[model samples]
Structures are given as structure tokens and as C-alpha cells.
Target: MKTDDAVSALGALANEHRLAVFRLLVQAGPEGRAAGVIAEKLDLPASSLSFHLAHLTRAGLILQRRESRSLIYSADFVAMNDLVGFLTENCCGGASCAPAAQAASKKRRAS
Candidate 1:
């Protein structure tokens, strides 16, 4: 992913509600969830959910599809993986990052 793309993706996820929506879609897997399901689970109004979904779509972080009359939303896993790869490129200067990941995990539990 280009730097600009990464920036856009990160910007989209910067909001609390957007982050929650994205995570929910990711958890939903490739099958995704309908727009109504998302709004209900997130306790967000339709207008608000539409706005966030549009934002994530523009950022290429999520995908939308029509299933009958329902609009389903799912995470763009390829884009997500690309963003992760871009961020972690040359990570630890080519050294293993497992140690760092482990440390971070431990820190999270300690807090």
C-alpha cells in the first residue's frame, strides 16, 4: 500500500464508532453482515451508520454488496493485510518482530 492509502485507512479508523464498525465487519468474515445488523449491534442510528460505512468504503477498508434487498458490509481483508504489511515493512530492520509483539501483549495484560 502506498503511504497515502495507509494514511486514508488510518484516518477512517481513527474514530471510535468507525473502529467498532470495522472490527465488527472483520469479525463477521467474508460473509459480512447486513447494514441493519451492523446498526443494531453498534446501537447507531441509520444515518450515522451510513456515514461511517461510506467513509470506510472510500478508504478501501470495507466492501459493500447487495443480497436481495439487504446491503452487506465486510472488511477488505486484502487491503487490511496490505496496510499491515506497509506499516510493518522493514519492521525491526528485518529482525523478528515476535519479541516485540510478545512484549506488547504482556504490557497490555500488565496494565
Candidate 2:
């Protein structure tokens, strides 16, 4: 991804509500969730959730679709992967940093 695109994605995720919404959508996978369901699960007002969803959608981090009467939202996994790849492309001087990062992540989870 380009630098500006990465920055935009990061900026979108910088907010608490937006980050929560994005993470929830990621966990929900490609099938996604309805707007009402997301609002209920996140305990957010419909208006507030709509604002965050719009921000994410504008950032190209998430996608929205109409399913009958409900609006469904899902993470854009390609954009997500591209952002991650961009961030980690030169990590630790490009010496296969993932193994160490994964080991540290596992250790932290085990704690």
C-alpha cells in the first residue's frame, strides 16, 4: 500500500469506537454483520456507530452492503493485509521478524 493509504487506515483505526468496530468486523470474518447487530454488540448508539462505519468505509478499511432492510459491514481483508504488509515489510531489517514477533505475542498471551 502507499504511504498515504497506510496513514489513512491507521488514522481511521486510531479512534476507540472505530477500532472496536473494525476488530469486531474482523472477528466476524467475511460474512460480516448487520448494522443493528453491530450496534447492539458494541453497545453503541445507531447514530454513533453509523459515523464510525462511515469513517472506516471512507478509509477503505471496511465495506458496507445492503442486505434487504439491513446494512451489512465487513472488514476489507485485502486492505488490512496490505497495511500490515507495509508496516512489517522492513521490520527488524527484514530478517524474518514474524517469528520473533509471534513468539512475543504468544508469550504475552500466555501471561
Candidate 3:
């Protein structure tokens, strides 16, 4: 994930409803949730859910498929991992000073 791609993904998630939908889909896992279920769970209208889903889809944060007449949505974990990688790639200035490295150090100490 390049900086531009990461920025776009982050920008798409900046909305309240979009963030809620993303979180819900992440919890739903690979099986995903139906559009109706998402709407009900979030107390949103179908149209509103559709709008958020479209945003997430365009951001490559989620995938949608047609299961019979229903639309199923799931998080795109690969894309998510890439985004995280991009954000942390330069952590600690290529040294071991980053928080992530520090967390790993603590784990080793605890052991």
C-alpha cells in the first residue's frame, strides 16, 4: 500500500457510519453479513447501509458478493494488513526504537 492508497483508505473510514459498517463486517469475518442484517444491527436504513458499503468497497476495505438475492459483505483482510504495514513500515527509523518493537521486547522479558 502506497501513501496515496493508505490515505484514501483512511479517508474513506473517516465517516461514522462507514466506520461502524467496517467494524461490523470485520467482526462478521469471511462469511460476511447481509445488507439487511447490517442495517438492523446499526439501526440504519437500507439506503444508508448501501451508501456506506459502497464507500468501503471502493476503498478496498471490504468485499461484497451476491448470495442468492442478498448481498454479503466481508472485510478485505489482505488490504487491511497492507494498510497497517504501510503505516508501520518506517517505524523506529529502521531501528528497534518503535513501540511495536518495544512491545515485542516486553513479551520476551515477560517470558
Q: Pick the candidate with the highest lDDT.
A: 1
Query: In candidate 3, residue 74 scores what lDDT?
Result: 95
Give the clashing residue pairs of candidate 3, or none.
Answer: none
Q: Please give the lDDT score for candidate 2.
A: 0.96
Give the least accurate 10-residue stretch of model 3, judged by summed lDDT: 92-101
Candidate 1 vs candidate 3, lDDT winner? 1
Best by TM-score: 1
Better of 2 and 3 by TM-score: 2
- The residue ranges of model 3 lying beyond 4 angstroms of the native Cα positions read 97-111
* Stretches of candidate 2 exceeding 4 Å from the true structure: 98-111
Per-residue CA lDDT of candidate 3, range 11-111, in tens?
Answer: 98999999999999889999999999999999999888888899999999999999999989999999989998998888767886667777999999999
Error of 2 at 66 (Å): 0.7
What is the alpha-carbon lDDT of model 1 when measured against the actual structure?
0.98
Report the alpha-carbon TM-score of model 1 versus the true structure: 0.94
Q: Model 1 segments beyond 4 Å from truth?
A: none
Clashes of each: 0, 0, 0
**What is the TM-score of each predicted model, taking all chains together?**
0.94, 0.89, 0.84
Worst 10 residues of 2 by lDDT: 89-98
Per residue, candidate 1 scores C-alpha lDDT tens digits across 24-54 of: 9999999999999999999999999999999
lDDT of each: 0.98, 0.96, 0.91
Between prediction 1 and prediction 2, the one with superior TM-score is 1
